[model samples]
Target: MSKISVTELNKISREIRQDILDMVYTAQSGHIGGSFSSTEIVTALYFSEMRHLDPADPKRADRDRFVLSKGHACPVWYASLCKLGYFEKYHLSSLRKINSILQGHPDMKSTPGIDCTTGSLGHGCAAATGMALEGLMAKDGRRVYSILGDGELNEGVVWETAMAAAKFKLDNLVFFVDKNNLQMDGTSDQIMPLFSIEDKFASFGWNVLTIDGHNMDQILESLKVARNTKGKPTCIVAETVKGKGVSFMEDVRNWHGKAPSKEEFESAMAELTA
Candidate 1:
């Protein structure tokens, strides 16, 4: 597969950010901040870095896998998938509606390209770990990637699964922690105090890398480093702003799960388009 230029990927990410705003604004009930925080990572993976994707055949063997551990941010994931041809653009407006495959969280059975159902935080990481183990055992070259929220690390299960991944030496597994520092209700420190996210993952026996999550260049390079690593799982600690592209919402806790009002939506759209 030919690599998408950095400029193109950046442009695609901007479009995905707009789609995210549109989805949450239309649904009137999606996690916008988290979705925005996740846009670039998803765009980079699907549009540029990943391998063996057949949008027409999402279940194709040998394809790389992505699990949205921070599953509330499915708006961004769905947007990227739609833009990537996994589904139609028209479905973008149906997010969070009853019976819509584009639910508030990703549904593997309902959504064409989703690898696993997620929403209950922490479990997506575990599921990705299992997939990585399966790939390693089968000796397949396929790689598995997962995106997690910093707030979700408060769950003890994440560490348990982290230990299991390292013990099994699942080198094909790479996880990105969207360390935006804020979660619903308050900041990570105010809520759970995620002491040194990089140290925690490193202590768990994984190769750890930290970078500005919003920087496309750093993200692309970090992903390359993760791919080259061996004998253990890798974790990229992505320091990101919660509401990345929009002016008013950046690092704002209220946007964690709030749908914007009409005025706010227009303001957001203005900035996204500008």
Candidate 2:
């Protein structure tokens, strides 16, 4: 597959950001901060890297899968699905509404293009590892890509899955940690210090790569190298701001799960478009 250029990827990222703002603003509930922070990473995956079947045929076993382990920051994933034509753009307005496909967390059954129902932090990666192991056992060539938050790494299960993936030599599994530094209550350091995520993954026997999560070129290059490497799983340490793009929201913990009001939404949109 041809690589998506930096210019094109940035364009898509901008659009995804807009979608996130629109969705959160409409629902009057959702996480916009982390969503913005992860916009570029998720955009590169869904639009440029991941290979899945038609959204309607989401259950097709042959398709590549993405599991959002840090599932609270799911607005980015939701935006990508909409942009990729998984569902109508209008449905995004109903996020978190009763009976809406856009739940507080992803539901594979309720939402097309969602691989697993994820919300409880630090669990999605373990499930993804199982899926990858299954693919290997079945002689299927699909890849499993999972994204976890830096804060979510506090959960021991993430490391357990990491260790398992390395032990199994599940090269088809690609994991990314959004190292935005901040969590819901406060910064990761204040909560639980993380010492060198790259080294941590490398020590676990993963083919580890570190890069700026917002840089399209770097993100794509790292992913390509990961895809080609054999005999071990790959983990990319993606450094990002807690809230990206909008100045006020950036790195603000309060925005972690808060929705913007009408006035705030308009102001944010103006900043994003600027």
Candidate 3:
């Protein structure tokens, strides 16, 4: 796919935010804060950075893979996939419904564009690392990408995967930490202080970059840098607002997994549309 201009990318991100709000409000239950937070990151990858992905051939072997390690934020992933024509747009309203392909968390078996079934927090990063390792062994030249919540960093398994990825020098892997600084409970600092995500990743022997997660240019540029770095996995620490683009929701912990009421939904849609 040809690269989309930053302006166009920003427009897509807004539309995605709208979709997230609509999906969660319609479902009356879904994660909105983290989904909104990671909107631009996921948008940039699906629209500009990833290679060998053909919506027509969702299972193409050479396609770059993306794992949403912070699976509650699957609304962002689902919105992007629907926009890219992975499945019918009608499924957006079916989010979290019984047997819906667009589940609360990702379900690879039912979703066309999902590369992995995730929702177990730190497990998805480990899965992405394994996929990167597999690609290296097979010499398929495929890259694996994943996004993890800063809150999820509390998982010891994430550190385990970090060590393993560095030990094997999995340069084909790139991970983004959605450092929104808020978890389901409270602020990251209040819940579990991760003093420096960048320093932590660097200490784990991975190449690390920190950027404004919501900035389209920084997001695209960081992905480029990740592609060029050699001999180690790359981690991009993206600083972002938890409930981005919505005034009432921004940085508000209650919005983490709560659906907007009709009034709240209207307010959010108006903000996003504006």
Candidate 4:
């Protein structure tokens, strides 16, 4: 209820994680691992780093913008938006349900507070780059942010978008790379090894920062640095475990998009609540 402190953010993170577990378990489908991995980043943005995210003015022009490039992890974004009052909390229960506005991926037209409808891996980058271009061209002070999964980085379009963001000196853009080593398949190294996620972005001429994605202080600090940066885009490559909070699920690739069974769900809830 007060200005959110780190303690409050941690508590909110746990609540959001529990909600994600419940949402995925009830729907019988949804990406919980990635959602859990992104918990602190999303919280730091909505509660601490981002500006003009007042849920009441969901579409305010010049407001800070965000896109979840890794759209399969919509559960975390949805939970944050709900907590921020962008939507009804009860809507969380419908995630991945047939005909639910809460679909398998984020839909800007369907969801409040979603800047871009990103389902395909690399498309979100293009969209976020476009939004940053729009803000820069208009000289609007608003900033644009997006999160890309490390696994999603395998797409060539991501590099293309990165180059475009740098070309225009779109310093208004900030990207958070959720560098969780495991994807829907097995380890990212086993599936598609990406050589130095930070180097790849730096090669594009964007400012780069790497941090432990789960660390509350580091996430907030990187966001502050990103906001102050100018002349090019900023990318925060965050190393995170796939399933961060639950003991059994941490870094487990199988949980990428699989709903937990009743027992696993209960166990996850207990850990998160604890």
Q: What is the C-alpha lDDT of each candidate?
A: 0.91, 0.88, 0.95, 0.90
Ranking by TM-score: 3, 1, 4, 2
Considering lDDT, which of the candidate structures 1 and 4 is the better prediction for this target? 1
- Those runs of model 2 whose alpha carbons end farther than 4 Å from true positions after fitting are 1-3
lDDT of 3 at 262: 89
**Candidate 4 Cα outliers beyond 4 Å, as residue runs:** 1-3
- Determine which window of 10 residues in candidate 1 has minimal summed lDDT: 53-62
lDDT order of candidates, best first? 3, 1, 4, 2
Tens-digit lDDT track of model 1 for 59-94? 877788999999999999998889878888999999
lDDT of 3 by residue, 1-274 (tens): 5897999999999999999999999999999999999999999999999987788899888889999999999999999999999989999999999989998899999999999999988999999999999999999999999999999999999999999999999999999999999988889999999998888999999999999999999999999999999999999999999999999999999999999888999988999999
The model with the greater lDDT, 2 or 3, is: 3
lDDT value for model 1: 0.91
RMSD of each: 0.8, 1.2, 0.7, 1.4
Candidate 2, clashing residue pairs?
Answer: none
Count of residue pairs whose backbone atoms collide, per candidate: 0, 0, 0, 0
TM-score of candidate 2 versus the correct structure, residues matched by position? 0.97
